[model samples]
Target chain A: MAAVVEASRGERDNQDQELVQRALTRDPAAVAALVRRMAPVVHVRVARALSRRRVEARGRDLRADMEDMVQEVFAALFESDGRALRAWHPERGLSLENFVGLLAEREVVSILRSGRRNPWTEDPTLDTTLNELDTDQQSSAEGRVASRQRLDQLMDRLRERLSPLGLHYFRLLFVEERGVAEVAEETSSTTDALYAWRSRLGRLVKQLARELDDEEEVSDE
Target chain B: MSEDLPIRVAQRLREEDEALDPRLERLAMGALSPEALAELEADAARDPELARQVALFRPLSSELQDRLTEQMSAPVAKVIRPARWTRWGLPIVTLAAAALLLMTLRGPSALPSYAGRVEGGDVVLRGEPTPAAQGRRVMRGDSLLTLELSPATQVDGAVVARAYVRTPAGARAAPGVPEVDPSGAVRLRGVARELLGVASGTVSVALVVARPGALPEPDAAFAPSEGPRLEVQLLLR
Candidate 1:
């Protein structure tokens, strides 16, 4: 089974690399294909970006605005010999979809910020250090690996504190990443109740994080 | 401290622990201070468990984003209709309606009555409360002689008794402390203009007793039936 999965992954990587090369060469069909595949995800990401900033579309045509943002993302990806597309190293074993989604999200957020009538004047969701971590350029790969290990240990401790309901909530919300409405309908609960549960779960995780941090500082001293 | 978080988030968490929403929101938006994000990254880098937590919560940021996006994308139906009434016209129409209602409420025959015995000469309908007997000219707003009864009726095994008056308008309980003395006395004073109307009519006064296991509705007693009763004759010319 493992070998089959590995073989499939290899085939997908080859396909992705070929598409990327074709797109970089400015093949019209290749570019169109990429756009078709990326548009929905890009539109979703852009909408998410603006919302996190609390940018109100107000009475404006939001669909048009989203289309405009998606266009801009495509334009950037294909500009100047498709530098961004070439820069993406699928050999790094990262999901190419996630990389493109993140790129599109960042580009959309930048466009929204620079928009002439942009409602948001601040980057409310910007965490520059995490942003730096995302690039993985500011820290050694080994350091990131070690940090991830420490994070796992802390999570195990938190898991112990969570009740069955809490665990179920985390699984549904985070692990499954299902929509709140969908989850609420499935569980026979109100969306408001689901939001409340999520808020509570977040607090529990943050509290546990704080306690873990305190213990680490004590040990370091 | 809870106030620092979004109202929805604070609604579900303890005051001390309610900042998670803003923290996560800021984290997702990349809005946290460089120092704080760096510290968080360092912590995650050093702790594998924390890294897993970070991984778990990474999707939550997107979940929130998707939720907000979905909300924004929902189509809002705007209904545009022609104005039914002008701004000034609305108030005038309202005032006229209110005036008509007031007239209907305060017109003659809006008076209420109470249950009591009507002796032959007890109720006198004149222009005012007077010693006039039997028949008298009654107009709108004229007071009638008070109704007085003596041993109007007796019921067996009646634990409680309630008296109500039936008028042309409606039936209402007599306005006084319920007193069924050993002599069984109930009296009521009313105006003919209010109870009988300006157009000369008769009103019926009835008493109902609630027997054990058979409690009579006070309003139901006002309906003429087989029960303790007194017939009062009022001739308003």
Candidate 2:
């Protein structure tokens, strides 16, 4: 069964390569075909990314925003003489669909980051952690020890709150840091199901963080 | 410290999952040989980022694949049937001919069109006089410009208007978000010099009206067939 799936994937990759070559030569049919094939994949990923944002959609229709963003993703691909599309390397094992999905995810992230008014208030700890990750070399030994202790405490609380399956998911998605598709396949779950789990996990983490903050405030007092 | 620790750790770990690498994709797809896979796994153990990437690679679902294939089955454009016009072709041709005849008999239909001209720093209806125009040249020394558009015919559906300025440098979309009045007229205000850019030659401003989602690219050449369009040329001194 695994072999059959791999064979099918390989065939599709070949067809995608042919279509891409035709698209690069200014073939209108190829361009339209490529857009039609990839739009839904791009749409799904963009929707997922937008769902993860803390900011409200600001009374704008999210479906419409997704559609426009999907168009922007295609425009980026086909623009500049299809420079981004040409960069896809199937020979190296990256499929066109996955490549486009990755691009869409990155674009949505960039858009959300740019539109952020106040980064600290939105998700301060996580934002600070990401910033620190970028400048890890500057951290003092004391800071590192405190950070490690906090991480261990958080992990213990998470283990108590989450079910075994949920903990496994957290391990795969956060600790191991796998892709949604990859994680879904390993868990024998659908992408939609995995996304739901992710959202639930995010909410749980935020709630726990707040509780921890309250405890610290009481201790400080 | 403990309260925020869990969320921050999770986020940092997730953030460490870098962009998809082709070799990592191969590992996920089971394309790598056993030895290669072991070597990659060993390397990933040493590198947290690589471990995250290797874990992240996976193929799209069969449902998505089916959707893509279904969409690709349809042709991008309607097939022109000049060579093979045998069965359904004659009827299609007759229907097209009848539609053309009806259009010709009805004369030009009342598709909405716009008329615009510069009055001092303001773009208004062609016949309207601006107070600034009486004292100064229309296109000179104006820091800001107002563009006003009104449909010449009754609009049946939602109409959208976009404005562009063409200069020796090239064409660019005029600044300012368009405001639509209840009467189906549209108005935009932008800086005159900025709209014209730094080019010191003939400048043309175009106002295009179309149904929602039908506007052409800002830099694309104006096609009347696309929608009702109006252009006014100004010679800069």
Candidate 3:
């Protein structure tokens, strides 16, 4: 089993190297292959993050968003100067799983951070409105109730690790729903920094969302 | 050079991972160091998928860690208390709350209590909203029970969570998760996850409604999720 696993890793590395070359050559097939190879990893990570989302849906609508996040990452990664990925180093002990995991985390975090939220609350307005809707009703379905709870948990987790500055940044950028120019003016930071932090924090949130989801899953077990 | 931060983040992640539930333990790019974490993380690290996941998360300062502990609590967000109140809340309380987190109760679960039974079909939310009306009908498959909007309304996916006051006017829809404006009419926002899907099976949303009055009744102000909400209405149908 160990030998088989090792062989598979080796084989995969070879494939990746070839794919990188072809991608760099602007081969669309390589890009497609890269997505096919990596999409599931991102999906799994994203689903896990969204699971942390904690909102119960009659239908799993967020699944669509999760899939989009992963797909976007693959598209970006493969759209290089030559469609070849410059970031990967397969031989130095980088695993595709980790590579994709990192990407998903960053993506998920950015998605969460980008949403304009309620600054005083640190909760996104959209999400908050949804929760309020759930609570106001006279009777609710068990499933919907569960979804609401999960949403709450996911939000709590997002706010959990935020620093004062980070929180302030998030408030200005997301909660306060400020523009990049506005955020820069308020923080005395450049627009680039604000953009970069949003991305960074977004990645962090995505990671946390996945973790929160896993936490939910683990608890189920 | 930039990668070193991931290393520190990974170390902290490993620490966090040890305490995390299994599925969440190793999803980021940097996580439990195979060597540094508890036995569980060490074992999880051996898997390339998990290890790769550890690397994906963002790294922040320790200040965030301390803040996380505080942020996870609703009581903290709601108010600041003295040491005595804080002591009562307890870290253990929050830790224990992991089990209790994400308990969203939408619709009739909002009210304190009352009961009826449905003989056939199931309750469902159908139709659109009006100034006087919010959502309509309740269904479980072909069988349907129409629902008239009340106050304090909440919706989870399809399930409704709400509470009722004395008069029909007082009774409202479920509590919206994040809280909504009632100036016009009933509107909903998704919030807090209630039940979770176990990896093996589909986690479903089941709806219920209770029209309980009086705060002191046996059915009054329950967990908001304890009873079969649609049962009474179902019985009526």
In terms of DockQ, the best-performing candidate is 2
Candidate 3, residue A152: the lDDT equals 46
- DockQ value of candidate 2: 0.04
For A34-70, candidate 3 gives per-residue lDDT tens digits of 4433444565556566544433222334534443455
lDDT per residue, candidate 3, B133-172, as tens digits?
A: 2122232332221211212212222232343212222222
Preferred candidate (DockQ higher): 1 or 3: 3
Poorly placed runs, candidate 2 (over 4 Å): A1-7, A115-221, B1-237
- Evaluate fnat for each of the predicted models and list the values in order: 0.00, 0.05, 0.00
The model with the greatest lDDT is 2
Off by over 4 Å in 3: A1-11, A56-60, A80-84, A116-221, B1-237
Full ranking by TM-score: 2, 3, 1
Q: Write the per-residue lDDT of candidate 2 for residues B1-237, one digit (tens) a residue.
A: 244444577764454334334355344332344465678888889996566444433223333322332223334332121211112345445644775676577654444544332333433234334322222223553344544454443344456777777776677776535555322456554445544453345676666666677676877634335455555555444
Cα displacement (Å) at residue A163, model 3: 20
Per-residue CA lDDT of model 2 for A50-71, tens digit only, reads 4333123323444445544555
Better of 1 and 2 by lDDT: 2
Interface RMSD for candidates 1 onward, in order: 34.2, 22.0, 25.4
Report the error of model 3 at residue B205, Å.
44
lDDT of 1 at B127: 56
Tens digits of per-residue lDDT for model 1 on A8-42? 23344565666678656544334433443354456
